[model samples]
Target: MLEEVKNYKLKHKNLKLIPITTKNYWEIGWLELKKEQEEFVGDNFKSMAYAYATVMEGKYAKAFGIYDGDESIGFLLIGHNSYSFEGCPKTLMHSYDLWRIMIDKDYQNIGYGKDAVKLAIDYILTFPDGEEDIITTSYVEGNECAKHIYESFGFKPNGDNYEDEITLVLKVK
Candidate 1:
């Protein structure tokens, strides 16, 4: 644990990950979804317009934003468990599902995402008397970068795909 903490601190020297709240929700939301939509549709104006409106709509699961000083640099969305499916049994489950993760394009390829995920895993593992022995997340089919990062943290695919999402699991035990 000490080593992990040290590594995290080293990686995030000037960065801090904070939970998202109502006050800075707009900034956080725009940073998280805006770039991806623009890249997806190849148009910034429409993407920005849609993201601005949807963000205010407040329809995310659990959301967190990483900040470097006052500027939001990354965001993660964890959806609450809604149903059970094959390979991932519902038995003895007390885990939050990592739904979406987005980092600023400028911060990509650095170690920020890895450190953020480590922070999230550490937070979950510290839960007192929690039945959660695992952390579950998914990556898009063509997102090789994400798959590699999650695998570095010991997450393995569970052979389950819902639409374009491929499920991966990290066991804490």
Candidate 2:
């Protein structure tokens, strides 16, 4: 799966990483996160709720939608966060958090989620050096599937947890 994802990102003419904008925000926000997947996602949010909260409240947040041809399959958000947990540190102000990641139920098991994760990490690596090189995210306990996918791409546990989820970090090198 890792090799498949890496290769897909290289020759990805069909997959696209599109910025979530005002006009098309509803498209991804409205996509289903499915009830079974909700336990892993740590919330009942329908992607758009995260979008609205990020847009209207958390000024530091940014959202994106994943597209395969014309179909929106996944949604994710990234932003600076210092208050999402209790032991949050000052260095995190220079860091970014992947606040949410989800693929539509119908889109599961087809590698869309893997491609989306690659896209997000690639996007994070685009910044100039000395400008925050860490990206963090979490998955609720019992979501070993998520942990495996993330770990496949070099994300490691940084000994942190948010609520019931285990925190993981990827350092862009």
Top TM-score model: 2
| lDDT digits (tens) for residues 39-95 of candidate 1 | 321222232343344445552234567776777887765543423445554421345
Model 2 RMSD in angstroms? 3.8
Model 1 gets an lDDT of 0.60
How do all models score by TM-score?
0.70, 0.79
Kindly give the number of clashing pairs for every candidate: 0, 0
Cα displacement (angstroms), candidate 1, residue 110, comes to 1.8
Per-candidate Cα RMSD to the true structure, in Å, reads 6.2, 3.8
lDDT of 2 by residue, 47-139 (tens): 556556755763466677878888888788767653444566443556777777888889887777777787877776665223566777778
Which structure among the candidates has the greatest lDDT?
2
Candidate 2 residue 50 Cα shift, in angstroms, is 4.7
Q: What TM-score would candidate 1 get against the native?
A: 0.70
